[model samples]
Target: MKQVEEILKRNHLSVTDSRQKIMQFFLNSKGALAHADIEKKTGENFDRVTVYRTLQSFVEKGIIHLIPTKDNSIKYALCKDDCEAGHHHDNHVHFICDECSKTICLDDVTVPQVKLPKGFTPQHAEMVVNGICGDCK
Candidate 1:
């Protein structure tokens, strides 16, 4: 809990009970989390709308990054410490285990650079690999 508070302070975000609980959830998660996951983990203590707003705030604060799955359901994962306000360097690939349906951040594998046509500017990119995870295999 203290660590979560410090993280919020470091990120220039005010520490709130909801934020702390939500941040702690992210810190303890082994992989990306969806809205339902969060709500289930938090139980009946937090309202659904509050959880959604908290996630939105975390994403805007760069405390978390969005992971888009093949089914179009988005998940959230903790961002690296270097990520700052309006800037996120989590360019690594996301791995979704087919067996367990878990989405993990592949920090060691970075996304390849792409050269765009003239007059085009790239803002962000995402790469996700689906396969059987080591635990499943």
Candidate 2:
């Protein structure tokens, strides 16, 4: 709870119950969490709109980042890097375990840069690898 509070304070966010519960969920999570997962974990304490707003605020504050899944659904995980407000420094790869169905962020493994053709520009890139994680092995 203290850690959650400190994170909220450091981010200059109000320490609301909904925010605390949602932040704690991320802290206790081992990997990325989907919207449904967060909704389930947060239980009936908050509505979908509140959860959505909180997630948006967190992302805007650089408290978390989005991961694109194979199903096209989005997932979120805590920012481990020195992510500042309005800027996320995470450019790492994401690994989804086949056996356990867990999505782990490979923070040390950066995404390879792609070469674009002339007159073309790249704004952002993401990489995802599917395999069994160490815990499952």
Candidate 3:
């Protein structure tokens, strides 16, 4: 509860039931989740618009990040320690299991720096390695 409050306060968002519930869901999640996944797990009582707006708020606040998938489905994941207001540097590799469609943060693997062509500036990088997760194997 205290953590939730602090997160909301830092993001300059007012605390609400939906926000708190979303925060708790993120905390309990083992990996990244799709919007539909969240709606399914939380139950039907949760409004779709409410969840969408809540997620948008979280993204803007840097509490989480939007990861784009090859299939065009956007996934949300918790931000790492390097994240800050309006900007985030995850610096961690992500593992996406093709079998289970699970997106897990591989904390042990830090993202390696890449050399870009001159006159190019890099902000953040999203590296996801797709394979069969241990549980699915």
Candidate 4:
């Protein structure tokens, strides 16, 4: 809880109960989480609208980064310490476990550089590898 509060403070966001709880959830989580996942984990203590707003705020503050899955269901995971507003350094590979369906950040495995066509400006990149995780395998 104290660490969550400090994170919020460092991100220049006002500390609130919802933010603290959400931050703690991310900190303890092993993989990215969807909106429904968070709701279920919190026992539905927070309203859907509140959770949505909190997620948006966290994304804007760079406390978390969006993970886009093949099914189009968006998930979020904690950002690295260097991530900040308008800049996210989570340019690493995300591994999705086939058995458990968990999406974890492979921080050690960075995304390879891609050469784009002329006149194209690359902003951000995401790479997700789907396979059986070590535990499942």
Candidate 5:
């Protein structure tokens, strides 16, 4: 709860039950979770619209990041180690398990620094590797 307050204060957002609950859920989760998966697992009475709106707010605040699956479903994950409230660190790869549709942050396998041609600027990058995870294998 104190951590949530600190996070909210740093992000310029007010601490609320819904927001705290949402953040705690992610912190407790083993990996990334889709919106639908969260709703199912939380067993809370929050409507889908509420969840979506909360997720949107969190993403906009840079407290979480949006990761899209190959099938186009959007998953939400906690920010990277260096991520702050208003700024994001999106230079990491995501690993998606083909068997269970689970997504894990491959922080250890960060994208290698790339050398782009001159006059090019890279704002962000993401790589998705699809395979069977250990739990599913």
Candidate 6:
């Protein structure tokens, strides 16, 4: 798609079919996607390693981000913020809908700041809320 091409150019990543299809999947997605799910979606077009490598490159380019799930499996979602390579400002809470089991990025809800004792430093913080989404309610 034209939009996908522009995003790839803006990110300074060369346009490729693998990247295009994978990125499109994220673009049209409703919520976070697991690696296996992505593979299943693109299995006929790409191999497992290609999908994995593409995901890693996308993360490095800040096109997508990782979401932590309760079962320990990671998921990917598009970066709504102005994320740059090696630097991302996706400091917001993620929501997991209990009814539909979808992972959504609550962009308007930011993660709460935590207080640390003296001599301690904080690098990053993330929050995941599990509930029924508005769609389900």
| Per-residue lDDT of model 5, residues 1-137, tens digit only | 47767777787777877777877788778789888876888867677887898889878878788786768889998855623444647468888888987888886777777889999999776788999999986
The global C-alpha lDDT for each of the candidates, from Candidate 1 onward, is 0.83, 0.83, 0.80, 0.84, 0.79, 0.84
lDDT score, candidate 3: 0.80
Residue 39 lDDT (model 6): 85
Candidate 3 wrong stretches, greater than 4 Å: 80-88, 117-121
Runs of candidate 2 with Cα error greater than 4 angstroms are 82-88
* Candidate 1 error regions (>4 Å): 80-90, 115-121
TM-scores for candidates 1 onward, in order: 0.85, 0.87, 0.82, 0.88, 0.83, 0.88
lDDT of 4 by residue, 58-88 (tens): 8887778888788989999885553334355
Worst 10 residues of 2 by lDDT: 79-88
User: 132 in model 4: Cα distance from truth in Å?
Assistant: 1.1
lDDT of 3 at 128: 79
Clashes (backbone N, CA, C under 3 Å), per candidate, total: 0, 0, 0, 0, 0, 0
Candidate 6 residue runs with Cα over 4 Å from true position: 42-44, 82-90, 117-119
**Residue 96 error, candidate 5, Å:** 0.2
**Cα deviation in Å at residue 25, candidate 4?**
0.8
Clashing residue pairs in candidate 2 are none
How displaced is residue 33 in candidate 2, in Å? 0.4
lDDT of 2 at 112: 96
> lDDT per residue, candidate 6, 1-137, as tens digits?
49778788888899999888888888888789998888887555688899899899888877788888879888998866643333457588999999998899998898999899999888999899999999999
Query: lDDT tens digits, residues 29-135, model 3?
Result: 87898999878897645899998999998887778876667998889888655233434554688889999889887767878889999999998777779999999
